[model samples]
Structure formats: structure tokens, C-alpha cells
Target: MLEEMVRPDVVVGGYRIEKKLGAGGFGKVFLAWRDGSPCALKFIHLESVGEWGWRELFIMLRHEFPNVVKLLSHFKWPEEKPEYLVLVMEYVPGVTLYQWARDKNPCARELVEKLLPLARALKAIHAKEVKHRDLKGDNVLVREADGAPVLVDFGAGTMPGAPRVTGALAPANLRYRSPEAVAFFLRENRKRGERYDYSVKDELYALGVILYVLVTDVYPFNGPDDELMAEIRAGKPKPPHVRNSRVPPALSNLCLRLLAKAQARVPDAEALCEALEELLEEAKADPHRWEMVLCYGWTADGRTTDDAPELVGHDSQAWLRRWIRQKPKRGRPPAPPVVAPAPREPPAPPVVAPASPEPPAPPTVAPAPAEPPTASTVPPLRTRVRRAAPVLMAVVGLAVVVGLGLAHVLGKFQPPPSTPNPGQSVLTSPVPAEFSPDGPTLWATHVHEVAPPWKPSEADAGAALSKADTPAPVTTVTLSSGTTHMKKKAPGSQAERAKKGNGSTGANVLLAVAAAANMACPGAQIRKEPAPQACPAGAVETMTRQLGLRLGERHGAGMPGEKQGSSEPVPVKAGPISVELAGDWDVGTDAMGRGGRTALPNGTHLTGQLCIGEKRVYGRITQAVTPTGDTFTVCMELIGQFDDERGLEIKSDGGAIKVHPRVEVKTVDRFE
Candidate 1:
């Protein structure tokens, strides 16, 4: 499987395949260069990776970057052959924490001090909207140039509102996943067709594990996957410092607090980074030990004893053998002939290279044309022939009729369905219901649920994913204050938090919205500097697509191999925003041409539109501003709607783009 992924021509997209960097069960990762920049190329085994799982990731953050693993391009060429999704990302030349810890086996004081930046980098990522769900030593890579650890592998990461299944996320992820993450990862109400949505705490918790490992140089809890999963599931991981006594009490306390199944105990990654920063400052004051988290077996005493042999020989092996013999006090077993095997050389592969072009003439011995077989002359049947003559005639007639029918049917053909996702609502974004004299209006555009493994594909799934033809479906949702309510919850999902709480008091702090924000997406509210119009009036028209993000922790779609294992997401939804407003907006998604736009129903329109295939979004209201202007105080807000799709978006008051280019097709930003 890994060999098939060793592409000789293209990496996915147009990036050239260079060399294989690493291989794992799910697929192989390659170090590649594209457009004169280096990026990590992650491939997926076609048989095991699910189509939707890959689509969801493509929809969310395939190309967005800076903090997240930027998806520069994706692979599509091997469509007809045994296919693989080649994901090209910013080539980060760094040592995985596993490699780092191993290289330094016992981490030095200098190495420990170097970890401050790693935490800071993670904080920076949290500031952006991405989290590293798989935060094991292997996933946390330290840049060789700066010694900063960047989180990679979002196969298990989630934008807020993404699904979290029990088996989808790795058990290692569970080790570092926060309490909110734990609760989300282990849902009690899945029987009611409910799945826990991943939250921000997922990243926070993983950050905690990273911090613990960084400080102590040992996994917070180490064991087999199932055993560790059970321990984490059963809350058996001892406080990080307990494994290493030299670990600072404050650091230990923080690690314990992070492991605590309490929201108040474990805060968000930002807050955790602050606390760890303080702890790291203290650890720097006095550095005595090194951390070797993933590597073990080499003991501190063994080094000194091992050195003794260099100066003075010690044959304890012979002494032990003499003690074991005992018969007639026999001295050594005749010193078994030390016949060491000779070193073998690695074999070289054979190669053939021709210097000149060969002539088109080959030694061809053509066989003579085959002679036609002579028809055998037979005697014609006469009258009063066999008694079975009528049956034979009937059989011949039936054969002729069947052959004719087969020919007629074979001549005709029918085209396959264009869009597989029909009937079932394949909503790109929710169309908010209007508020009336009654209670409130809430009309949600539901996601078409994944059908059985053998079910026919959805028409829209085909159309939305199709690059050949069929325009993607688009929707215009009214963005009134009412439509800005928090995302929905899976059915009967309260049991997880309810298990720890008094039912009425709501100790489910992890269940809060903050826990599961899209780790890699732009926020729901726009954040432009110098105070952008007081966060907008009525409802802030923020834009995001239904990417495969779970914000904090991602649940499994199914088992590994059947789905991508925490490395990449597949494109499931994409769209941009179109609106008219005075406030400035910033948008981000896990896709290209996937931005947002905003425009008031009848007032000045501002669209936060994302070009679905471009993975770029920009703009604010067309305001009269200069370097010296925008000082006057004026405010006017109007209700509007947002239109979007996985690839395109459009929304405005009335004028058409054809009628007024300036009024409609204004160049906000080309953030290439």
C-alpha cells in the first residue's frame, strides 16, 4: 500500500513527487516542493480512507495556513488508477518530539528551556482557529531552525460542530484530550443516533499532554493502545510529575489540573499556555534533568557502569557461566567459539539505459494467414425423419428470439444521475427562519446523512465534488440576529456532561461553546483591529463552511482504514458570504474559493464571500475612509442575508453585477 503511494510523477495537484519521508499504516508522507516552496505531502490509502471523510477536510481547511498545517494543494491525478489523495502543505523541516526526545534521550536543561517557544507556537495556533487533535510526541514537530514545535495531522482535528465518535480518534489523542474533549469523545447517547461534537478543549487537553511530555520527557501515560485508552477512559493516568520526581510542583500541579476531569481545572489552550509559560520560566531558573518521553531502557547508572568497561575489563558473563556450571567446578564452557557473522553488503538494483534510439524494424516472423475451414458436407434430412424434429425446431426459434432481444437491449444506453445528493437536503449553510409575532423562527438546512456503505452515492455529492461539470448548489440564508444562534447539538448528547454534574447545576463546563470552536476556521465574529464597529449590529454576519472540523476533538467517522486516520479531511461543503454592512469582516475556511459575503436586505451591503475553489475571502463595507478619515462617529445597521456555496457566493440589495460593476463587483481584496 505504501509503495503505491510512492508516486513517480505528480504528488497530488501539480506538485512534483520528490522523495518519501515517512510511512505508516494509513499512508506515506513525502517531503515535496511546489512552486519553489517545500511542503509535506501526506497520502492516504484509497481502500481505507472514506470519500466523505476526505471531502469534509477539503471543505474546511485544505489550503488555509500560518498556524494550521496548510493544505497548499491536493492530489487528483490517480483517479482512474488505484487512487490516493496527495495533500501538499508547507514543508516544515523539524524533528518530531519523538525524534527530539530520542536524539536527546535524556533531555538537557537547554533542551527543556527550548520548549517555551513550542508552547508559544501552539498558543499562536490556538489564537488562529486550528487545534492539533493528535498531539503525541510524533505529531509535535520541532523546527530545526528555531526549535519551535508545530502541531500537524488534523485527520482527527475538528472545526466546532464536527462529529466525534468513540473509535475515530486515536487513544493517544484521548490521553491529551481535555475533560470537555473526554466527555465529547466518550458520548453516552450515541444509541439515539447522536454523536458528540468536538470542542476547543480537545486542543487544550492535547496541549496539556504535550506540556506534560515536554516537561518530564515521558508520555503522561504510556502503555498499549487499548490499555492506555482504558486507563484514560477510566481516569487512571497519574499526575505527570508523579512519574518524574524532579518535575516542578507547579508544573506537576498544572499537569494534574489539566488531567482533571473538570473544566475549571483544565482551561483553554491560551490560558494553559500562559500558565505553562510561567511554569517554564520557573523551570529555567534551575535545570537539572532531561526529558526522554518516548524513549526508555537506557538507565542513568548504566552509562557509568558501561564506561567502566572501557578502562578496565569485567567478564561477569564468564563468572556467571562458571557459577551456573557447578559440575567439577568446570571453568567456562570451553569459551564457545566466538564466530561472528561476517558483515553483508546491501545489494544494488539492476538498471538498463540505451544510448541510441532503436530502429522500428524487429525480427518478426509473421505466420501465414490461417486457411479457412472447409464446411463439412452433410446429408439433408428427409421426410419421416426423427420423432424429435419438432422440439429441435422450437429450440432454434427460441435461441434466435433471445439473441435478437439481447441485441436490441445492448444497443440502447442511459446516462448516470448528475447529482447523487437529491431529496435529502444538502444544505451548504443554514437558512435562518424569520422572527414573527409568535416565539421564534428556526429553519436549519440539514446535512445529508451518510448512507449505508452499499447505498448509491448522493446526486449532489457527485455534483458538488465533480470538477468536470454541474454547478454546485448555493443558498441565501437571512442573517438576522435570530439566525446567529449557536450551532445545534446531537440528540441525547447531554449524558456525558450529566454524568459528572448534579443535572441541574450544569458542571459540564466543557460543553460550553468555547470548548469546541473550529480549531482551524475563522471565528463566528469578525475581529478587525482598532475596534471594528462594535462587533456589528443586529447579527454579525460571519461566514464559515460545513468543514470537517470538530474545533477541539474529532470523533471517528468509522474505524481506521475505513476512514482517514487523523491526517486530512475530505471536502464535504464550501461557500462564501455576500452581504452589505458598515462593519469590516475577516473570513477563513478549510478550502479554496470558500469564503463568505454579507449584504443588507436593502441597505449598504458587505459580503464576506469565500471563493469555493480559491480558498480566499475578503472585504468589509464600502466605507468612505482615508488615512485621516473614519474619525467621525456615525452608525447605521440593517438586516441582511448571506449567500454562499462550496465554490461561489453572491448577495446584494438590488443592483446586478451586469448593471453596475462598481456597485456590485468591487475589488475588496485578492489575498493571494
Candidate 2:
């Protein structure tokens, strides 16, 4: 969210743009201060989305829902820059329910008790006209302040009584939506020419699911896409008691009622709250049942501290039947076990004539009680003992099973340490980005790496200018160029130049550098000639070198600086020659021992500067280098008697290497 902070162009309503707080599909929310008190500001994103926020705000204007995140004020973005549609609203500062759940995971007696408040808070939200389309753990922000949870992100949708958010994105909760909502939303966006309406029952149903998860830590329905949806919509959910016998029948019945698909099965939020309050009161009175519900729980992944039974099986059917058929509960005497008259004892005495007429089937005697039991018709000690024995044994087995399951879950299910590995890891950092109502601005965690000159230095200028020489036209070799008139020639060099008129000596120097460079920096190409004309607008080269290279003229090699004494645009040309450099070319050095810049093969001279930006750079690049094709360093500098200021500009053709420095390079036309 930090990434979203930007100064808005215009302030909306009375709130000045402070910084963006959070944002979503509809618009961005800002942390704003008014009259010296902090208030949240929400701005619409686009006109379409803004309309929805407008509608929702209108519907909920004065109504207040305690558990919901507060909505402060509304406004229209001041400008019509398609770029930004913004909004500002209340700022919520509580931890999300997901985080709370994670902290309190591995539900136990204490944790389950903690969940009751969250369940109630959800109940409150359902009471409000708003349906928190999303009821997932993350959507529920739980702050222990005042010992209650708060729901936030009162988001976008065509809420029950409200129209779509004029500026809202969309209101849909993927994780905890009810079956009907899920079907309605998934079925089609529009039906019968009207948009589908998400109902309030959906929220209540979601509330029931929340309770279910709180108790069991598992969704009643489980499976893959088609399978999971089918599971949610299909069969009867098992009672909570089935998962944890600690859950009393009363609570289990409540769960079943809420879970029932029949719309009337579960009451509305208000009624549900009343029922829950009663159940909770009862639970308080009965601690044993409460303990059991708390101790055993489930996760959607089938994790349970109690024996988890998938009730859709034969044994489950038998058990359910047995439970149903248990002799009418204690107080009700099962309609007096019908008794028939006792047969005559004489029939028994006639048993000796058993052989006679099959003894008349023993006269069908209905035996009389040997002894009249005290008030109760208790079964014999033996019969009673036998029946009670299995139940006691079953109880003992269940205890053992519960203990083992608890050990397995609690023993191994400790929270894993926070260390990410390749499989689930992505290179992520809090991208200094945040949500803004006016639209997001690009924010960087760090500045981009670049090359720039902070100081003006001859070495720097030369380095910038003397980029690699161009690929010369395939032609014959010749050289031409001119020198400034105002130089006090060095005696020995002057004598040397005069000794060899028209600089046959300079030509010799060129050939020598080219030859040595081939073997020295053999990989390096040295032009055996000089440039004939000026390069394009953005490029620059030395006049002497330009004329000497003769790369400009289309026709022929006019002459070398054969007319050195002349100051005319010396027509020039060069014969077929490959690029080469001297073996001992003095490379420029930086504050560090060595620099990457290499001196131009002696005869080459600085013609002019290239304008990169506000500055003119001397290393007017002649051409790009090979492979990745970026400008290589060059050696170029204008000669003057003494104090002349030099500046440089850097630039690129805007490709992979889009950035460069501002070197002050001067331009020249056909120079002699």
C-alpha cells in the first residue's frame, strides 16, 4: 500500500490529498484529516464504478451496523483525468480474521470460546441490510479491543436494498458464500433481463458456515470443484455432535436447523441471535457439553481432534438407526409393555403327555413374574449388566480413540517455521505500492542504475565523445583533413611536418597505427583512412579526422590534407582498409587505476561535439559497437591555446540502453 501514495492533482470536497490508504476494484481510499481529526476518504475509480458506491452510500446513509467498518464521507474526484477515479472512506486498523485464526489455530476449549464473539459479530452484520458478500477469514477483521470482532470492506454489489456501487468494483465473496449465492452468481450474470440480486439469507447462511468452521475448523462440504459444489448443495450435513460428542444434542440440532436447505429451516439473523443466546446460556450452565465442543474440531482438510466420520456409509446408517430406536427416553414408559393372560399351570403338568398331540404346544403359557420387583420392572442383574457392558466398553473405546487422535494432531501439527522454499516461493517484497482512489502511480523500491557525469573533466568529455568509429563504406584508401592556423608548432614536429610537405608523414603515421593495431589489438578494427564529411544531427567527429577519413564524399578521394595550409572543406576519400589501433595507445584513467577509453589512432582529431541534452559532449559518437550494439568509448577533444570550457552530453537511440549523459558536443558541416 505504501506504493500508492501520490499527491492528487486536485483536492475533492474539502479533504486535501494526504496519502492513499487502501484501494480496491471500485475506488481507492485515503487516510485524510479534517478539522484536525483523521477521517477516511474514498474516491471513485471510474464513472461506472462510482455510481455503485453512490447508490450503496445512499442506501446506508444513516443506518449503522456496529460490527461493520465505518464509512466516513463521500466525494467526487475533482478532475476528469480518465487516469484516476478515487474515493476516501474510514480507515480500519484491526488485524484480519485470517491472521487471528492463524494465531489461534489448533482450536481448543479456550479458542472455541474466543470464537463465539466473532460469530455474534457476524450475526450483527447480517442484521444490517448489507450482506458482506465476502465472509472469508481475511474479510473479518478481528481486534480484541472491547473483546469483539469487526467486519470491514463494506464492499461493492447490488446489495439487498441498494443499487450497485456507482464507483465500486464488484461484491462477491469466493470463500464463504452460501450455496444459493454461489449458484446464482455462477449461473449467469443476468437472467430474465434483470441483474440477479444477492439476498440477505445468503449472509446468514454464511454466518452458519462460520459457526460450523469455528466449532469444527472444517467446512461441512468438502470436494473438488464440481464435487465440492455438489457436496454443499446435496445431502444433509452431519450434526456437530457426530464430530465431537462434546457438542450436545441441542447445539447439534441447532446446527442441523441452520444447515437445512429448506429456507425456513434457519431463522433470520435476529431470530438466530436469540436462539444462539439461549443456546449459549444453556451451554454456560452445562460446562461438560461446552468442553466437548471446544476440545474437538475440524479443518476443511479433514483434520479433527475427534474421530471424523463421513456419515454417508452403511455403519453410520446402522448407528443412526440404533440411536433413533433407543427405548423411549427415560421418563416415558413405552406404553406399558403389553402383557397377555398367564396360561393355566395345568397345561404345564400335562406336559408328561408331550407325546400326545404335541402336548398342545405347552398350553401357550405366558409366564408370570417369579417375584414382584420393587416399583420398577428392572431387568435381571445379569441382563442389565450385559447390556450396559457394551455401552461402557464403547465409551471407553471412544475415549481411547479421542486421546490418540488428539495426540496425533497436537503432537505433529505444531506451526511450521517461516522459511520459504522454491516450490511455494516467489520473489516478493512489499512492492512499495498501495491503492489510491485517484489511480496508482509507479513507485520504485530503488532508483534505476545509470551513468552520468557529476563533474566536467577533459577525460570525461573525451571518453564520452570518442565512441566507436562507424563501419566505413567499402572503398579505396585515401586521407584528407585540415589543422587550425593558430598553433605555435613544436620545433621538432614542425620541422618534421615541413620536412615532409602535405603530411606524407601523417599518412605514414596512419598506416603505422593501423598496421600495429591489427596485430596488437588484432581483434580491433582500425580505419586506414579518415572521415570525409560531418555525421548526422546527433553524431559528431573531429574535422581533421572527418576530412581525413573522407567518409562524406560519394565520388572519389579528392586528396589527403594535401592542402593542409588551406582552410576549405577538403574533399576526402579512403581506399579499402580495415579498422586497427596502435599497440601502445594510452588508455584514459579514472580515479581508479584504469579507464575503458582508448585513444583514437593518433591521426584522428576532434572535429566537433554532439548535443545530448542541455550540454554538448565532445565524444560525439561516430558509430555503435558490435554484438549488443551500444556506443563504445571514444577519444575526442578540441585543441585551444589555453582556457576554453568543455561540457558533455550523453544519449542513446532509446533501446535496451535508453539512458545516457548530457555531454556538450559542437556540430560542424563539411570541414577542411
Clashes of each: 99, 96
TM-score of each: 0.40, 0.39
Overall lDDT per candidate, in order of appearance: 0.35, 0.37
Per-residue lDDT tens digits for candidate 2, residues 450-503, read 101111111111221222222332111121110010112344552234322221
RMSD, every candidate, angstroms: 29.0, 37.5
Candidate 2: C-alpha RMSD to true structure equals 37.5
Highest lDDT scorer: 2
Model 2 scores a C-alpha lDDT of: 0.37
lDDT tens digits by residue: candidate 1, 178-249: 445444545655465544444555555565666665554434553322233445555545454443444556
